[model samples]
Target chain A: MAELSKTDQVEDLHLVNLTKRFGEVAAVDDLTLTIPAGSFFALLGASGCGKTTTLRMVAGLEDPTSGSIRIGDKDVTRLRAFKRPVNTVFQSYALFPHLDIFENVAFGLRRRGVKNIKPIVEAMLELVELGHLARRKPTQLSGGQQQRVAVARALINKPDVLLLDEPLGALDLKLRRQMQIELKRIQTEVGTTFVHVTHDQEEAMTMADTIAVMNAGRIEQMGSPAEIYELPRTVFVANFLGQSNLIEGRVSGAGEMLDVAAHERSFRLPRERSSATGASIILGVRPEKMTVLDAPDAARVPEGHNVLSGRVTDVSYTGVSTQYLVQASWGQELVVFEQNLIVGDRCEVGDEVVVHWSPRHSFGLDGNEDIHAGVDSAVLALESVDSAPAAGDGE
Target chain B: MAPVLPSAAVAPPSTVAQRRSRTGYVLLFPGMTWLAVFFAIPFVTLFVTSLQTPVPGKSGRYQLGLEFGNYATALAEYWPAFVRSFAYAGIATLLALIIGYPLAYFIAFRSGRWRGLMLVLVIAPSFASFLLRTYAWKTILADESPVTSFFNALHLLPDGRILNTSIAVIAGLTYNFLPFMVLPLYAALERIDPRLIEAANDLYASPVTAFRKITWPLSMPGVVAGTLLTFIPAAGDYINAELLGSTKDRMVGNAIQTNFIEFRDYPTASALSFALMAAILILVFTYIRRAGTEDLV
Candidate 1:
């Protein structure tokens, strides 16, 4: 039998091949990660993608089917949930209804046998800006106030790792936005390692320093937010985080520079960045990374920039920016986002246009992958937002 | 600037609608009148009868008069019975709570797929005749019964006499009222979000501490409701005492029943009954206030 390696470095929370199976289904498969100490990390995925389950496993609420969990150097795999040095801010805020705000915040200290808790509890309430409502029951507070109370209560324990399971999922859009900033500020001030699990990509991008995009119980990609967005390693990551246009092409050498061809239109693919050369590949570019101009303005295409001629299939005016779906000659609807430089002078549908982007903006992935994986779901989401005016109005 | 609508524009139509809406109150007339006749009228008659006095030196004969002394006599005579009634009921209520809380907790939190089956079993005994079930206990605890003999062999019972004792009466009360205690407790425990308990554990509370701080306090509303449901009925019950207790353990309810039926002393019986109702009301009110769950009722 091989003995498990026990390292001496005790800097972060580590999971070694943690797996949780609910009968025939594996909610969280063999997953391993090392979250650096004092860093704000996020597990991002759609619902049922195992992000929340992974968070629960880390919190010790759910026991692993196999493998171990460690906080710093201590192996806490078999430890009771209450004995772990971690706390959670549940999605529903689960405040103690019978307790007033002050007592609720003091619960942890009191449980740990601290007789003098007034000072700490009061300071925590003040920190959450809820000092005036210390005497109020949880039921009397609004959703946002209760959320802060939940945060304060968990944070008062001074746990080494704080897990937030979609803490702002219950709040309205405006309050959710406000709390995203508040949470980031609090994490920065306290310097506590925060592992936030959320399905909302915008929320994850706005708050986390490092993000692991999870899918089907495994991490599809893990990196800094910019890296995950600008240089995704999987087709799922490219479309899940934000909108991406994956242009199908065949990669080949084109003397002095490498290029990918699709329907006689070629785009640059740097040789050093090419992983699977001489094979069919997919070139990905973010909607905002590309620029659109009238076809007649072909001379405007800068040197060394890739260009494609297409006709605008659809245009959506969203106040800040306009999203255009261009039906390229390569037989794909390439999405392009442009700022509303001239509000009313937007390009109409069916207008001939040329799309151009720098070579560095292109991201390449294996062509034998699901091209339409996350696109339709995003479109359905947008359609729901459009159909329900109140949903969009709240945002 | 919008023009103000005149009151006549809405007043007449609303008045007509209000007239039509009186049918709702009219529909409630029968049930209201039934309660007034059956419940309210009898209560008033009982109050009057309690204030009456028996004709001088004549048995089974009473004259209506404002004789408050009837209450004094009943209280003076049956004070011990009143005390025993409340004591037996209080002990029975406490026992039911101690036993029922864990049963309810198990069913609510851990029964999983068998929850409905467990609840049915809790209520199954109530479907049979209450008297028949209590009679079954009498047979189970008979002097030569296996349970009593086993207890004697184990030396758990010094005398091995459980039948016709205060302990028997209290046991009968607890058994009969156990469902009342368990159901409300189960409801309260089931309504609680399991996540709250998880949150408690996450906040550094051991399982015991979580139960003490969260489960127990949150389930107080159920305790208050269950205790009242069990205690109030158990206080006024006479069947258990008559079947399982001797004269020494007779409660106020037995005295009232004996006075009204066998002795034909209506005035004293009515007085004793009124006293029991008043005492229970006061106790319930004080308890609810002290428990700080006044809003539950």
Candidate 2:
């Protein structure tokens, strides 16, 4: 399990055991991450997950209590923020009110006393398509224009690392989506290391080459958007990214492969995992993974799979897709999605159907059997328990 | 700029932007008119007065004679006073800047509620009698006072005499105007988005470099405002000189007051006031013009 620690496979900017605390509470704690260069890396998290704190440390706004931050071979732990080869596009865009678009873009270069600034400033502005609006003051510019200027301001400095702190959060949804693509294209063209901080899962999904999902004050998982979406390592990660159904099950049998048991059914799990039998697990699968089968799904499918019958409790049209909320035999509600066409066979509410999905599509926690037993008994006893009160009255 | 109501091109209707602009103009006119009347009229009056002369008479009284002699003589007679005022005010402004900057930076960038409380303290003396504060400093610096006693205990001054000197006048000026210097600087520094300083540091600016490039430049509006405030009042101040100093330390205001109160010479007093006003107009206007607050704001 610890073998990966010995090998250094990541590049971009590596934060080695970074930790920061304000008074007593830890803001960023023992966080180690490697953001590869030429990748639009997003630190995706909820508020207070230490994502912003981590970004700020790299931006040199907050000094880490202990850690070494290296951009390539340069150790920038002790370097002043301005002296570091990184620049930030703040959440508010923070354009200097005094300067016009051109001067605002030229601010960093001028601060360093660059010998020739006009050509580079022009190029950066042109790159952001702001050449026509160069003479306009920040006040006269629209939100999108100002956002581009903020990007141009950071990029004109030719920093080794560019940090974007929710750069598109202020924009409308349509503009934000447009900027996401624009940001990705610009990052690719420049090949500069971009560290973007965002709370929007969709924004990270659309633009990021690598995404680090953070929870509490740590990285829940760091991988590509697809990897995190399809193969979340924790229940928290699975739920945070998108809608997921959690099914409690126990590894009933195991040798070359494992068998997962929930309620009265025994289902074989894929053979990749080496965890022992009778281990408690929480099976996870995306809503799109579950299919509504017309016929009764086979009760005892051969090893390496399973099936369940349920009633479609609800149906919702989401324009591009239709969603079905199905209650399984174990009384667990599972979400399923079907592609919506101009004309197609769509399941109606209250339709009895088989909820089917591959075993490989589901991810399970390694251990803790009590959760499975707790959930199973409570669900199985639900109907009998309700009738017991009536039976007691009759007696 | 979200308009209160959307403007429809095809419909005949009033829009928020149009209504707001109208109301804004209404609100703006009064202050603009007040400035035009008070500030604008006085400067015109002073300029016109500078050209008028004292008609030569045995009674030392005159009619409005259109001659520049009054201005010429006032300048020639009070050249030393003007120079002394300049030197004193210049030194006081420099000292005020040195002292006020750290106070301003602390209040603006460091303190929170304390910033507001501290601001009240800085400007508190102005709410009291200005003459009393100057006179208090005179008493404190006296040979018999506790300050002199402390100096005497230290054996720092042989005679331990601080009253009735140039030092006392400058001290009075600095003490009286320290708040003016701090307030503008505090405002300028406070408004300077802290993110810029952080951005500078992230770009690898050291503490000193950040101050030099970001903090200092950003606070220039305050520096300019403070210099003007300290200098203009200190140059024209007669109370400190009268209360705390002898003949050598008397500034331009003392000379003007002597003409008006002692000599009963209206023409010379008006000429002196007009001369000082002109000099101040030139100096302050030039400085404010160069301060470039338009860009910073």
Q: Residue A319: error of model 1 in Å?
A: 4.1
Quote model 1's TM-score for chain B: 0.91
Over the stretch B104-172, how does candidate 1's per-residue lDDT look in tens digits?
A: 999999999999999999999999999999999899878888877887888876556878888889999
Tens digits of per-residue lDDT for model 1 on A1-395? 01111111225999899898999998888999999988899998877778888888888899899989998889989988899888899988888888899988888888888776787788778778999999889888888888899999998877888899988777767777898999998888777889999877888889999999988788888999999998887888888888898888888885645688878888896665444444788888899999998988889999999999999999998888899999997668889999888645677899999999988888788777788776554554344323422211221
For residue A204, model 2's alpha carbon misses the true position, in angstroms, by 1.4
The native-contact fraction of candidate 2 is 0.62
Cα error of candidate 1 at position B293, Å = 1.1
Q: Calculate DockQ per candidate and list them.
A: 0.59, 0.42
Candidate 2 lDDT: 0.77
lDDT of 2 by residue, A70-94 (tens): 9888899987676777889998887
Each candidate's clash count: 0, 12
The CAPRI class of candidate 2 is acceptable
